[model samples]
Target chain A: MSARHHPADAVLADYAAGTLRPGFDIVVAAHVESCERCRRHVRLFEKAAGAMMSDLPPAEMSADALPLMLARLERNPPAASADAPIAPPRDTRSLIERLPVKRRRWLAPGVWVQPIDVPQLPGDKLYFLRVAAGIRGLHHGHSGPEFTAVVSGALRDGKTTYRAGDFIECDTEVVHRPKVLAQDGGCLCIAASEGSLKGQGFLGELIRTIAGV
Target chain B: MTPEPSIETSEPARELAPEDLIVAIAVRADRDAFARLFQLFAPRLKSYLIGLGTTPPAAEELAQEAMLSVWRKAAFFNRSRAGASTWIFTIARNLRIDAARKERSALAYAVDLSEEPDAPEQPDAIVSGAERDLKVREALKSLTPDQVTVVRMSFFQEKPHSEIAADLGIPLGTVKSRVRLAMARLRERLEELL
Candidate 1:
């Protein structure tokens, strides 16, 4: 599916350069897996990186480096093919299913949160939030940027509707409540937040206290 | 290892391009070809790692490991998909990421390494690796020097736009715009080539 909303060009460039924080990177990657245009953008950025690398002045290697490499090569044979499995065969599961979820916590009656096991800096958080159709999410503002990739179904925030594979980035200035479209069954989103949520209302504060998002 | 007459010695007059050298290793398991590839890229790879703030000794080790990966994964090289340098750069990039991940946590985080199924090919995706590399180099040259500098800082030094703006003593909005403009110019130039 083509993604209507995408991460900004600078973010994709960072992803290409391997410079994005792990939490941000995972969210972008999930979008890229489904969005061909962003993938093309990433490829171009990577090509730029490769070209720049090719033109850099060479660094000195230790004199014995080549011989040491040759010795290591003698012990390791080439893989039969690129597709030859280094990891176990990946089953035909959705991205959310493949990820290791730490635990599921009920945030509300129809909404539950499952934390994805991703390495993050002390203040950063990554998790999946699945809200049943017609449910309105907590009204909150981010302490820092929050990235979300829609894994399934659809949600509407403000005027824009984000469907499966769409990406949304919320900065500190964006404070709003989102609702899942009733026709879409439910919405599952993988979100990465740089810092805690600033709850706007009493209910928002209660959910934030319990969810620790 | 049996001592065979060196391919370099036998063919002293002919110089194989990096792409051909990889193909030679893949098809014939040619040691001399692998040696030639190493000589061409190992130093450059080390320099790249160093540019990204790796300590010199660690960069050197990572470069060696990257080249070793190139050797082991030679059979997977598809010249049509990526040029020698681009492919090698990706190898080094992945190694750096993996190394950083290891430093952060002892338990392996389930980062998905499996190749996602290919999307339907777009028009530009069909461009051959060598041609695309050449086009990319040309496109880069077409960008303004300031634009190039921003691109380099973002890609090589791994600086966020805010950090880059701070380093350059410019506004963050200017840095963001420069990056956006640079990428647009590149896409335009490459599209013209296509």
Candidate 2:
């Protein structure tokens, strides 16, 4: 899709300052993933943020913080913790699985999710997924700018394959098929649709309806 | 640990377009580069956050979190569209919006998702008669106190409307009109600055 600019200045300024609500932040992030102009402005903000972070009083770890952490490590034992006795590592799960899930706003069998590491946001839809590989999900349009970063595994759009930790931004102008490329682990992704998703046609609408999303 | 002065003070600190390169070094687990990134952004981020109605501690938390994200996700940096700082800046911006939105009502004044951007219609650069940053500053100074408050508060709010109400303890409708008036005045002020 053709790229869109970043959110307007007031919003951009707030975003740069790190004062926006987490939900709104998610929407802008998803949009930033796709829009370069917004990214450029955001870069300026990040530079400013870095400079500011340096100015803050040094962040000291809690007194005895290291020992407390170490004591926990010793009690659990590194070997035992590695063994995954209590919470079995869904080897099928990605590292994102270990993090807290964003509250799922839209959930279904084919898709459900919980936010992870995101602060808070609004008008942004967070989706979790259990995709069957090779399923050709409908090609879709971004109603506005959208950002999707991979919390785990990956999904493919046309020629690009988004792996775990990858950041993908799509604007309302994009039209592409997002197909899952089965990783060693099943793919798990965190997607924030900034505004809304414009289903390509009846087919896309059909998929959304079936999933009740 | 900070490197010795002999260690080159991180990422060469020279290249005119070191943005992507800065991101690359940061991705390599280089704390010094990360420090440079922090030096580049945190203040503006803080100013922006303060605009949102967040307490100082909350704003600082956003800064730390955004920076940590740079540390963890620097490797994902892509240069085709923007520089490293911009990419990270956008992340911080998005996170800030998220932080303010949790307990608030839906983002009423936020971007209308249904609307699509005109296919990259290049905004004619607002002519900065002075230097680029200077023009922004000049425009800021030109605004009335009310306008400035609106702009500053704009920087703070997730939705922008209610924060004005809460900040000023006025009604929501009053906040909306004032914001509109301030924005209109700002656009005019910017024209002179440009």
Candidate 3:
């Protein structure tokens, strides 16, 4: 974990401040589970947010607020139904293991993509990318911000290699081909993007057109 | 006339910190304790969600759901890690994400926002406690209005730097720097409490 890259301070601040989109938040959550340092930083940001919240002027509430809450308590069984259950203790597995829905399909040989249903994001933009070892991805540039968190194994984009728990954010300025390292079992990643990826070269364009990432 | 907020003069439940009340609910599933917490935070949560552009009805419903989560997940609260306001706010924030996503897709929102502690290693409990100090409040006040404006925009408006720039008619870089500077100052001042 020490050698893995972490999310930038700005991104972590956005996550703690509740400003990040849901799709991006998922990527950050996956990374936080693996990086203790980022987790500590996030806690501090939460504390700061709390202080800010305390200082805001209190807003008036309806007369029924407390009564409604009490009613809910009365109606709910001591242990309620399965709706919105509390999270089980922390699972060390990748973020995909925790996903409650499965609507995945294959994009290519040794490459599978699962487009998560995040309502607040562009359709088909946020998905999981699983690539077998020894496979190489297309050379691509993003139309907007793209965040990818490695759940397991390692992948190399140009000279930088991202390992499990590492987070990589690329924007329009970045254009590279990512290849899964053969030494690792393979790579599973939760990836999110603000817009569609724009691929370079014929093979890259073909993959991008078919995958629609 | 609207009801006054000071009606609890004789109520013994007024002085306890939110952390204590949360722990109470967590350990015993105390309804009264949960009621007090709801009374204190629900309204604030409602206003917060509304301020972030959620419609009034939706915001109210969101607030209710957030409080319900507080009751259901109280067992996970760790006072050594977060204050009551901080913990509650985190719950609200997570709910907002779920709420936003649920509105967009047919898929049910099932991911746990607070499934794990923010940090693997224990954070300094002092920072959570110190955030409430008068000095920290004064430090917040010490920021230039522009800095404060950007901070508020970032945290409350949920507007990105580019959007904030467009809204304020300033350059995006200026907006980014303002937010960065404000956070640095706030973190520096708050850290001194330790």
Which candidate number maximizes DockQ? 1
- lDDT at B9, model 2: 40
The C-alpha stretches of model 2 lying farther than 4 A from their native spots are A1-213, B1-30, B43-61, B72-88, B97-132, B158-174, B185-194
Query: Comparing 2 and 3 by TM-score, which wins?
Result: 3
lDDT (C-alpha) at residue B155 in model 2: 43
lDDT of 1 at A20: 80
Here, model 3's chain A TM-score works out at 0.82
Tens-digit lDDT string for candidate 2 (B45-110): 554565445666676667666666555555545443333444555566656645654522123112
- Model 3: how far is B87 from its true place, Å? 1.6
Give one digit per residue, the lDDT tens place, for model 2 in A1-213: 434223555445455555544444554544554455554554443333333333334433335533433343223321212123554443433223433454554433344445444443455555555554555566778775566555455577878877654556575568888887754355665555655566778866865565433
* Model 1 Cα lDDT, one tens digit per residue, A1-213: 788999987788777778888777778877876777877777667777777787778899899988899989889877777666774564655555666688899998899998878678887888999999999988888898999999999999989999999999898889989999999999999999988999887987888889888
In candidate 3, what are the lDDT values of residues B1-194, reduced to their tens digit? 11212223433444556766776676667777788888878878877787789988888888898888788777777665566788788878877876666542112112233344443444343334334535556767777888777767777777767888999999987877787788777666655542
Candidate 3's displacement at residue A35, Å, is: 0.6
- Residue B69, candidate 1: alpha-carbon lDDT: 84
**B72 Cα displacement, candidate 1 (Å):** 0.4
Better of 1 and 2 by TM-score: 1
